[model samples]
Structure formats: structure tokens, C-alpha cells
Target: MKQSLILTILVTLTSFQRASAIPFQVRADLDSCLNSAGLTSIYPSSSGYASAAQAYNLRFQYSPAALVYPTSENAVAAAVKCAGSLNVPVSARSGGHSYAAYGLGGQDGALVVDLSKLKAITINSDQTATIQTGNRLGDVALTLYNNGGRAMPHGTSPEVGVGGHLGCGGFGLDSRMWGLFLDQALSARVVLSNGTIVAASPSENSDLFWAIRGAAPSFGIVTEYKFKTYPAPSSNIIFSYSYWSTPQATASSIFSAFQTFAQTSAPPTLGIQAILASAGAPGQLYVSLTGVFYGTKSDFNNAINPLLTKIPKPQGTSVVTYGWLDSLVQLGGQSLNTSTTPDGTDTFFAKSLMVPQEAPMTSAAIQSFFNYLGNQGTSSDTVSLTTLYSMHCEP
Candidate 1:
């Protein structure tokens, strides 16, 4: 059986009501309209309201006027139209996995358009897929593998919603070879702010289509996505080696060696990433090199051996091969199912920058960065720096 899970929250006005906002009676009217339009799951401040308002990041929490679940696109349109009529702000929630909790409005008093119930996966005759925005990367990966040994390049986190991930450019283990998730999108069905449904693609609504490719949440609620998929590779190999910085072998030396390997030895089929972090030991820093190669174990080892020889002595090393579905599970670092709830939710602040492939970091700059990292305390709350090197065409 197919499964669709939608979680929408309408925060109660409670102590946060404002005199300039819509009246209580108008809010009730909007609720009545949605319920009449076949939105069966409506939660006020009571009932599953707390859980409905929770986001993947526990840091930001806010309540909406009401939580709703729309089973179909028409039901979504109805909720939007009703909210517009009542002058109530609406926010769309798909998987509720936004790090900043944007699905919860980052504030309060907004109707959340939960799209979880829209989950559906249809494999077409062509090498393409019609996927509902509510599906998570994990569910999508597993489903594609099961149906036709197909796969889409997406983020490692299985809990990330297709709506947000594809909307804002997705990067994954195989991204170096296949490309980002947004590059796979062929077309989309979106609900405009005025409660109108429209199709966006290169041939139709070209401007909206281009805008939604990267900045989706700003435009409207996306109901469905049509994506190009690739045939699953027969096998994938994951390799990792961890090194502890010491008097003889320093983090600077390791980073310099990594930059050389990445620039000289890395291939398109191999995705390389490095992390400089303290492994629960104060004043002790460690550098870890991890790679994913989309090929057999022998080829992976052959490609990775020379680079390993260039780096410092390792505290630990591991290499394992996995099938397509198993590779996604390992990449996610968690077991994922078709549940609407996200797994790996925590308070974190993240930032990333893109560097030109041709320009490699200088050894002095690498040493400086490692010195700064070394100064940071090795507390549980300490922040770590992770660098990913993926080679592909500019999107």
C-alpha cells in the first residue's frame, strides 16, 4: 500500500493574539471552510498540537492558528484560499525538517500547509519519476530501487523532504557523478499564493520554473516534482581513515596532504570530504578523511590507495561496499522509514562556501585554519568544520 503523511499546525492565538490581526470569529470561519472542504485532520491548541508544531530543529517552536492535513491538491488549494480570505498567513510544511524551522513560520500565527499526505511515487516509461513533494529522500531512494533499480542524486539525510531539498539544490554522495538533485528536476506542479494551481517547466511558466528551482519556498507551495533518475550502480564503496594530530604528525600536514590528493588524485566518480574535530578529548584535534566511490571494491581501493599513502598515520580505517539502497542507508547515518517525523534533529548552525575547483588552498592558509580550530575548546557543544570536494558543472 502507498503511504502519505501530512503534518499541518494552526497555532492557537492564546496569549499571542494581536489587535490588528484577524478576529477570532474570522479564524473560526477559516477552520470551518477547510473542514467543509474535506480536510479531516484539524487540530486546535489542544490534541496533537504540540507535536504538530514541532520542527526537526528543536530550537525554534511556534504554534499556528490551526493544523490541517489536505489529502489532495484540491484540498490544499481550498486551505490556501480559505486562509487568504481570512487574511491569515500560511506556511507550507513538508517533512518539517527545515533547520531554521521555517515550516513553523519562525514565529507564530500562520497556517501550515502540510503536504505529507501528498506522498506518491510513479515511475514512468521514460527514465523519469513523478514524485510528490512530501516524500523524503530515504523513502524515495528505497522506492526507486525496489521498483526498477533506479536512483536520484539527493542529500544523504533521508528525513529531508523532497520539496525543500530539490527546491534549494540538493547534494549527495554521488553528486559528483550524477549532479545535484535540482538538476534532475524536469518539471513541477506548484500552488500559487492566490490559490491557483500551475505547472512550471522550461517550456511553461519558464520564469517561475527557474525561480522555484533554487528558491521554492519563497514563491508558493509545490505539490509535485517530476525528476530524471539514473540507473543504480551495481555497487558503491565507502572508505574512511581518521588521524590524530600530534607533535610529529600535525593537522596542518594532514590538511596539506588532503589538498594535494583532492587536486591531483581525486576522480569524478569519487566524492571526498574531510572533517577537523575534537573527538571528545580536550586539546586534542583529529582529521578524518572520508570518500565514496561508485564502483567495485577493487577499483575503489586502487583509486584511493595512493592518496592514503600521502596522508599521516591513521588512528582508525574502514572500507565497506553496499548496494544502492544500502548505500543510501549508510549515507544517511540513520535508519529511515516512510514516517513523517525526522530522525537526526538537533540544534546546529551551519554555513558553506563554494570554492573554484582549479584553485587549491595554500599550505599556510590550511595551517592557519587548523591552528584556529585547535584553539577552540573540545567541549560537547564545540563546533566542527567539514569540507566537501565535489566536481561537477556549474548549475
Candidate 2:
């Protein structure tokens, strides 16, 4: 990979020397808007870019015609209008957590509306929470826990923006019982491409409401989201089980059994995740089955006990029950303070594949894929894989 990258760079330097077109009058217009809107600076070249992470890649950078921070929706509207008038590409960036660069991918000479200044969270008497575009996941969770344990199922990390999470169908441990984050969405205030501001809800702007629920980036800039909150459950029981197996086939059988058990009798309160990894054993797989049970210990035990025969093992298992909020802090990795980096953020790049069904060929295919991954030059410790059965809207 290193050699390939070096060769590509050498070829690029030798072959490419084209300059971009710039309109002097458009630059003057943009400068006028920036001055009036109190923007810090506008960078038209690579020097003005900074490294930022979406949920995935660590080294992603966005080169914007102007990285303008607006203090108000009106100011944002003004900037958007200016960009539209000048035929400039515009991308809205809240917390910069879009893994595929959906929020920061500039075509050329694009205007980036950075909404980090819009952070705000307010809880209403009806147990509904209003979150701004810039608010992060953990921030909202902590605030909700403090305000009386009124909480909603949110993404695992705290640095992810509320806008992106809800926009992309966010889910967490409690999702097996509740639903995706968009399921709780009540309303949103959006700034359209044409600079028209509108409020969307179940009753008003219903088409836009449906679109923004799951396909937000294709729509417009969502300034704020109102979500219906549930009374935070009192206690949560987390069960961890790790298995030691000899060969890939044995581990794969366990996974297949898990799929069967999860399908027939898994309770709504039980959410399970299996991590197939090679922590200590080379070419061997360790199956870590973790569960978040949203019920009393007795009820949880009763619900999961019937399926233990499917996972016959001499491996290790641990269970802990705590207040829901405290369990969240622990399970979501906030207790280690490793949830974010030194600058309060980390990058995660992940891809997902949906398996419609499993056959002999499918199992063999997966085994080959894992074998290839084990051969990669990078340390195996740096890579992780998790699979789960998502309970969508059934409960």
C-alpha cells in the first residue's frame, strides 16, 4: 500500500498542474458577506483546511471557499443565499461525523456552514427534549440523566452530532426495546436549499418530515430536533459472555446457534451483540456475547436461561446490574474516558454487510474472508468486528 501510494503521488506530481477558475466579483461578494457575518477567515486553498473526523476516517479534511460560523439562523440563511447566488456548492457541517463525507464533501469552491455554535438542549414539561444541530450524543444523554432520568435511546459515542445521528437512523443498546432515534423524532426546523425556513412535523410539512426522518442530508439543513423521551428505566442488567473455541467451524457453529436462538425466543428487553475476534489465539475466534437487559435481574435470568444450552461452554461470564444511566455510562465506554480523544473526539471507520441467508457456501465464504483479514499486515488488535440482530419497530 505504501509503495502504491508513493507511486501514485509521483505520477500525480509529474502529470497534474491544472489551476482552478475563480471569479473576482464572486470573491468580493463572499468577502462582503463574511465581513458582515463576523466570520473569522475564508480559506480558498489547501492551507486553510484542517483535519476533521466523521464517524469513520481520521484524516478527512474539507476545503471550503469559506468556513463560516454563523451566530443565528438568519446569518446562516444569508450565507446560504450568497453561495446559491454565486453558484457555489454548499455543504452543512454540524459535528462533522458523516462517515462518507456527506456533510463536508465539497465539489469545488464550496461554502461550508459550520453549525458548532448552535449547541443547545432544552427539556420540556412533557418529557420531550429539544436538541440543536451541534449537540453531541453524550452531552444530551448526560443532560437528560441529570434533569430527572428522562432519556431517549441514542448512539454510543458522545461526540456524534444529534443531527447526524437522527438523520442516519441511530440506535444503541436500548434500541431492542425502544426503536431507532428517528422513531422518537417529534419535529424539526429546516433551512431549505432555496433559503426558505420551515418547521416539519407529523401534521405540517408531512412529506418533508418523512424525508428528513431517515433521509435528512438529501433534504436540507436541520437546525433543531424535538424528540419524545421515555421515562428512564430504573435498572439495567448487562451480561457478558466470552467463549473459547478450537477451530473456525466451531466458532461459526456457535454464531449460527446464536442466530437461531435470537430469532425464536429472544425477549424485547434483551439486546445481544457478538464480537468475533482474535484477541489471544491466532487463527482462532473468540465469541463475545454481550447483552443489555432492560428488566430486573430475576426477569432477565428467566428470559435468557432457556437459551443457555445453545451456548455450552467453559468460558467466562460476568453480569452487573445498575441504574440505567450509570449502566449507560459504563457500557458506552464513558467510564474509561476513552470515548473521545484528547481533543474530545475519535474517528471510527466501519462498513456493514447484510446477510440475507446462510448456506454452506456462505459459511465457507466468510471463513475465507476472515482468513484474508488475518493475513493483513496491520495488527489485528487495531481491527474489530461486531454483528447484532436489530429489532426494528416490532416491540
Pick by lDDT: which candidate is best? 1
Q: Compute the lDDT of residue 113 as modeled in candidate 2.
A: 79
Residue-by-residue lDDT tens digits, candidate 2, 16-43: 1223344777777887766776765545
lDDT, candidate 1, residue 375? 59
Per-residue lDDT of model 1, residues 1-395, tens digit only: 11111111112121222222346897778778887887865555457877777767665667677767788888888888888888888888877777667776666678888888899899999969999988888889888888889998887888888888877777776776887798899999999988999999999999999998888888888899899998999888887888765432276787677667666666668876776665445446777788689998788888887787876678888888888778777878776575744455565544444444465666666665555555543533444434344321111
- Pick the TM-score winner: 1
Model 2 TM-score on a 0 to 1 scale: 0.82
Q: Tell me each candidate's TM-score.
A: 0.87, 0.82
- Model 1: per-residue Cα lDDT at residue 175: 73
lDDT of 2 at 64: 53
